[model samples]
Target: MIELSEVMLEMKDIIKDFPGVRALDHVNLKAYKGEVLALVGENGAGKSTLMKVLSGVHPASTHEGEIYIKGERKKFANTKEAESAGVAIIHQELNLIPGMSVAENIFLDRQYTNGPSINWGKLYNETEKVLARLNIYDIEPTDLIKDLTVGKQQMIEIAKALSLNAEILVLDEPTSALTDSEVDELFRVINELKEQGVCMVFISHKMEEIEQIADRVAVLRDGKSIGDITKIEDITLDGIITRMVGDEVDEMFPKEKFERGEKTLEVRDLEVDHPLREGEKKVKGVSFEAYKGEILGIAGLMGSGRTELVSGIFGAYPDDTHGEVYIRGDKVEINSPEEAVEHGIGLIPEDRKEIGLLLTRNVVDNVSAASLSKFSTMGVMNEQEERKNTREYVDQLSIKTPSIDANVATLSGGNQQKVVIGKWLTTDPDILILDEPTRGIDVGAKVEIHRLMNKLVEQGVTVIMISSELPEVLGMSDRVLVMCEGEAVATLDRAEATKEKVMEYASGNF
Candidate 1:
């Protein structure tokens, strides 16, 4: 029988330092069998650094640390060695190969082979059994991962970890990409894993999810452990936030209203057909208007076409869209993002890593990507102007980086998001569309972005935001547009909108 009280994994006096920065300083953490340990921290607070050290991404010699598994001290030279010792990390950015089948990704490196060739039938059968064990019936073993939704892709990631026979699972912000129902399903699977004596480490920014799923909570701040591990019931959300940030944040959502101006953008009879499905429309006659000096919010559940509607207007899906988009009452033809930008429209996409920033490029390149025309003379980019423009926006947006030339991949999630925003701001668009702008960022950054939105409105720029976070929608927008299925079902003024009411409209309750 598995001993639930026994510590499955332990880290002692771990110290990891990067160039010019000590990322983790004497951090200690432990995970017991059958318990979910929640790790909480601000961006760059060393939570991920500590986990990377344990997973051998930093190796033992690179960091000062002692790792014990099952009461035996062990040293891992690489990620493969750590995995062989039963440690698996499911990262925030999924590590699945999109073109491969779900079954292939699950048994990736270790295939069921016959004479050094894969046995397809046995692979499919084993994959089906793993899916059955997880009570996931919707996904087929042979379906390509690219065809699956983000939620299903995450499940495939979990299944891959299980295939490794991982005794210690490190889930880094697993539900950041999931819908409400998907989140519930993931929680159920985590519970099942706990019952099977799997020691799990969960890192998340959502306080409610931490309270719901974590058995114990540990807080990290400024590369140091702020306090010892404590039971979930003993710590409040305020307590956790205080320890994570080392400051009192009185309100999570701060709203500042401003006077409205003339209409800056107007969309009429906007319709978009499904790209893959013929004669099927994803957005149906969606009409809305945004004025200068006001933030308009779009609220909807998953698969409600909120993103499609915005993308279509931004000319991201011109091949399958039909819409009358007007900027400052002048009808515009925006068949591509270039045309949209020429018409003074900017979009901060929902998936920042995928669509917003060039991950391998430096911060200067990303911030100046959209507005290269401003720095070009006679069809050649002026390096001086480009660097000057990038520096200006970096300062304006408060982007944290060692220098403007740092690779975007090295920055934390929040800082990456700020760079994306700065990229759009450099375009000098009169209108901006932000989809899930604050999805994975920390609370401090969220507030900063909210304040920036207000500042933009004050500067006479119209803002349209789509978010699943209800508090953000209510607190930031002057008006809320509720979408369901493929249409705009309700538009409520800020004074009239409530969480329950918007949810009812979003869920088709009314």
Candidate 2:
């Protein structure tokens, strides 16, 4: 527990606003030395906006806020000024040059030099010291960033912050992409930092993670502080969630039962080679089937070949993939995404920004991108028809945006995800493959998406999902397939699939 006298960072009376939105309204936060303070909220609850205010991404003049470190007020004009003031934030998306070496990325833009030349030996040696301070021994200073795992890259991000001698650290969804074992390692390092009197502000949408690591919890709702920061032991998970969402969340999963219909999609002995590695197989001899009017869930840990299996089936990697896919009792070949789409298959990829979204485009363009043929005549698009169709979907999905003309990037994480789903739905596919559909989204959005899935299944559309969250799989799936090491090890019915059972299969424990 953190003592009251040891407050290391405090953000008081923060009020930030945009053109039509008051993102943060007089919000306050405090973090004490040697403790983890968790900031919990639904999407669009001003959590990211508040962090931007603190990190100088919004700037002091832009947001009305006062920040203090050790009881001394500080004004930061930019991120460099914030870093100079002993503040550092590791964003949700890692910001590192993948082609560079670890040492080079760690000391990016600020290199050790002798006159006009970089000091290679001194730079690597200094990087080694920073890594050693964090008890990281497996990664060498000269290793390429792309060669390392996601977890190792996260550690390097933390090391870079520590290299700047940052006293207050802010982590934004640090474990969102990590494996279970990797999350454990990250928690271990977090504990180590706590012992060294480094104050941390953790922002996450995960409830289990809050229970595991948070000493105190602060909830934000509709750009306002829900209440005072409360001790973790004094509140229930439901209580925190209620504070965040401003309502009783009686049913987070809301799974519905539907009659299973005929077999809609089937795959046999699917194999996909790793995109980069020469001889390594990502998905090896995997087979699965999805039935109409049912949601089939694929469960596994990260890197357990869950994403690769679905991608292979969706024809994301055509030349390197070999599989026999059958849709509606007839064997079909899917050599590309276009072929899969034409065969009534839709895939919502895991990485929404990289593979799913057009950040710079508007909602109408993004939604109609896959099905422009319906709104086009003589090779020219009908703009009014496109807008009307997009508006219909925007209302159907309850996507929050000022206008259909607003850039997709302006919406929150949840809304952006809905846009991706809307894009695929325009194609009117019979079989939907959703890879991490609810990943990194807030509780409200997750429930909404689940409800939409229920609606789809009731209409006889086949739904197949791949998720790392075990509880989601157990709650929503009629049948769950557990994968481990590029193989489908077990298939369990919803009645028999518990978290423990799924984890056992996912870890290859038999």
Candidate 3:
């Protein structure tokens, strides 16, 4: 069937290089006009690089490749040129201004003008048309971008992309931040687009999604195409993963048990007030306990206040939070992150780039950031000691980098997360709260992070994790705490937490 359709997009020998690294090596791709081509690969395997070349983010002269649209070759100078060529990309990280209205953000550069002055009414009306095209009625065009939930912002990103009327659309980790209901809506829109003869290239690490939504899959490894484009029905999940990692993959979770120790941290009647809305709370009266040798997974849908609860306990918003925390039966005063670190608490935030890493710096600097005192004397710095300490973690955590001095921005998603973990590990905390620790990384990297959690637990660290992925919570958590809205609806033991049961509690049906 695909063979009968026209080739909407094609790439031949795409070679993308950055400094000394060759991100893409003679990679080739082909997609039919109405079909979805799934691009699956491990982090650092050149998926993003190849997409950049195609989307004109890298530009025509930056890479060695021939990109053809509808059997006609194109040379794009910038993103606008690519858009003119009917190419648009929705990046994993949303490109939206928090202060602007949705209408302004959607048609930012190309606003509808009435002679010299801008016509605000026309802008809002055009934005409404775009939202209506996506069947997104909940969001108003006048709404500020920051007021929306992440899921809604993500939907707005899709609406903005679709408004371009792209003939060849690239969705990079589009569903990573989306909820299940939003995902279903997105799939429905995608199917509608397929019927309209719009070609799509989907890049995701979630295999189940690829199997569900993709017509064909193309695997990449070490900056090269592993095999030819194959129909999604012709391959198993295991087969695709094998092509990705270049070997037979083992147990996905790699969960190991350890003896439960004393209660290391306890939260009683914790609440975090909304920063923007008066009398509204992001986290309600939530209570939980974490022991010395177990992974406590918090499961909930997006906007369920899971992150707020952990951040409140970590003293991230101590001024606006009301909570009672006990560390090993000792009531301590923790009104700031410094005090939390002094009380032996470390939190890995859900958004690593925004809150975790110093992207402009190197691995050594990021690893030594939280524990600078250890490598400093009398307000002076010790670069050697910092590098030595970072090297130890690089080896211990198996972090992949060109060197200790490699820029944090240059590393892959998995390695960036490892760097964040290594940063917290230097603090030597008794309690570690990881919010979406393995969010966007591949299956291989996820297993490594899970094993690292087990290692931390065995070493007498109390681990608290929040994951949107239900399978990860069920597979790796010793106990699952289900949250609905801002309340803890249920806390089930490992044996009691099934996918359906957890969803029931999370959906507020139980």
lDDT of 2 by residue, 132-230 (tens): 888999999899999999999999999999999998999999999898889999999999899888999999988999999989999999999988999
Best by TM-score: 2
Clashes within 3 Å, all models in order: 0, 0, 0
Task: List where candidate 2 sits over 4 angstroms from the true fold.
Answer: 113-121, 276-280
Q: lDDT values of the candidates?
A: 0.90, 0.91, 0.90
Cα deviation of 168, candidate 2, in Å = 0.7
Query: C-alpha displacement of 120 in model 1, angstroms?
Result: 5.6
**Residue-wise C-alpha lDDT for candidate 1, range 315-361, written one tens digit per residue:** 99888889798888889889999888989899999999999999999
Candidate order by decreasing lDDT: 2, 1, 3
- Winning model by lDDT: 2
Backbone clashes in model 2, listed as residue pairs = none
The TM-scores of all predictions, comma-separated, are 0.93, 0.96, 0.93
Which stretches of candidate 1 lie above 4 Å from their native place? 1-4, 98-101, 113-129, 137-147, 380-382
How should the candidates be ordered by TM-score, best one leading?
2, 3, 1
Candidate 1, residue 299: the lDDT equals: 97
